[model samples]
Target: MLDLFGDEDTLALAESHRTLPGRFGAGTRDRAGVLSALSALSQQAGGAEFGIVLGSGFEGAPDLIAEIGARHRLLGAAPETVAALNDPFRLAALCARLAIPHPAITAGPVADRDAWLVKRIGGCGGSHIRASATGSTPPGHYLQARMPGRAFALNFLSDGRRIEPLALTEQWQAPSPLRPFRYAGALARGRDEAEPIPPAIEARIAEAALRLARETGLTGLASADCLVEGERWWLLEINPRPGATLDVLDRRPTPLLLQHIEASLGRMPAIEASPTDATGAEICYAARTCPAMPPLDWPDHVHDRPRVGSPVARDAPLCTVTASGPEAVTVKEELRSRTAQVRTLLEETENSHEFQHERPEPQRPGGTAGREPRR
Candidate 1:
């Protein structure tokens, strides 16, 4: 078993092996490296149950699956349908095929430098994505006219035929006139803060997603990233796997991860809305500068947290702090206050001597017993 991103517990569930390089970044060379790694891992883990690949992690693994070629040819309908549903040269091609209204797009790369976006033809998580300045375009990529307006991501789950929307989150990117827009975090907008999705646009997105599933024979969880300008909804990209909001899905009574696993095993459960409807604004607060990893000396109260020596990076996920109340503003304020406390605690831990010399425990299966954070 080759579990690329597996933690100790996850590894215990399968036969673990080494990881392939370039699982995170985007570039022709890196993408190629990832593909090669996947292929090697697949060959190594022959006859294992279905392989679940994340992001560029899928590169070559599919080839290793015994019947994957036939399965993809027979079951992978959405990818092919999306490819043929629209002409790469025209924006209207997608709109016509999906029966949705969108900002007009040219079929090919825009000749004018300021009017086009050169984007990857695959999934979207802010990877391998870029906007073109007319003449500066990458080869072998899809080009479409850029749509103007704020961006919104609607996260949902599907059971082949039935689709259940979880939440519509507003994405925030740092205001950088010089740098390409990068996804920072998501905000759970309340009634006042929530941006309303018109029925027409919602219907269009849902229909397109369903049609995609039907075409591709997708049977489990997936997400669609779309842009909303005025009343128009423009399809951005579709992810065949879980999205960044997987943690949000974890808050559900039956975690989306479990659901996906079950679906993959051919046990499709009845899809339902998340058990918890508590909603306010949820935003990912991050450091504008590098924040050092804090030591683990939590009080005896908090439990089941990461160890003191866990390696955390700038963009690597730390922990998600959520707040909810009867109203949106109150929840937003609560989350903000809570996040500040977390940051302060982390900073204090960094400055403390305990963090500098604490030795992490040996790797153990479900070894989180005493190491959990005491909040």
Candidate 2:
């Protein structure tokens, strides 16, 4: 899996960002390379226990995953199921079949582009999504009618028949001229065991997730992207794997891979609510082209340290800042403040440099091992 973290000792590791010097992923474009690299690496590191694919790029191309699965055991959804969910029209159809609330989805552009968004199939982190304008129907894309409300994500553990809700998180996107709709991060507002569950919304979301999981055979750590407006809840998509915000929502001693493996094996480990207050993670992006990665005196709160001298492009995320507190509002404010501080530090470092003569590299590696700094 190409992500932020490497595989545990129990499993052979083959992921992007193999070391601290790795760059971020460029979606499915890196699959071929990751596939080749993992092939040799998997052989060397004592055959993999199972493959866990990551990101929207992986979601976009299910066939590639299927092929990889042939060589390595994969612990997530079947390729066919991924294909069904990857298609927006099919996902909406499934929602209707399962009686789940969903926004009106169109196979083509809607009349009012302002109220619609053109989204690519299987795109993650809202990167391949854009406001609909032209009536043109791009291949592998669909128009989703915008709904009124703030976005919320439900991170849950599923045994393919029953769902154990983990945490309910709020989604944020940091938009820029270069990278509009880039995923910012998430805040864990509610947990199933400890944190307070919002009145009716929690039950509705859990019911939807349970039904979908049973129907699709989704297991392990997966997330449901949803929108809540008034007393109603609408599910946007279901990512059938351990996703971003796994850290923010779950600060418990149990590691994420353990939870995922247990659920995949049909085990429901006892989960307790967060004992602390609301906690969140936010990514600070590069507002302008920078010469080199700044020297950040990272406290325990900061994560995903950039490789020294790695050039960051305009709108690309620099690093993630984290904060936890008793109140939700306080945590949110702290994350915002930290984000600004990091951005300021990067700017100051760039301006003071005699100029390192660095530019953002175009060739991004495919073998990633870190969680995306995504909402």
Q: Indicate which candidate wins on TM-score.
A: 2
Model 1 lDDT, full chain set: 0.48
Q: Please report the TM-score between candidate 2 and the true structure.
A: 0.85
**Per-residue lDDT tens digits of candidate 1, residues 49-93?**
365534332322333322333332222223333343223343345
Q: Local error of candidate 2 at 85, Å?
A: 2.1
Task: TM-score for candidate 1, please give it.
Answer: 0.66
Candidate 1 off by > 4 Å: 1-20, 27-95, 102-109, 159-162, 175-179, 187-195, 262-268, 273-276, 279-292, 297-319, 357-375
Q: Whole-model lDDT, candidate 2?
A: 0.69
Considering summed lDDT, which 10 consecutive residues are worst modelled in model 1? 366-375
Q: How large is the C-alpha RMSD of every model relative to the true structure?
A: 7.2, 4.5
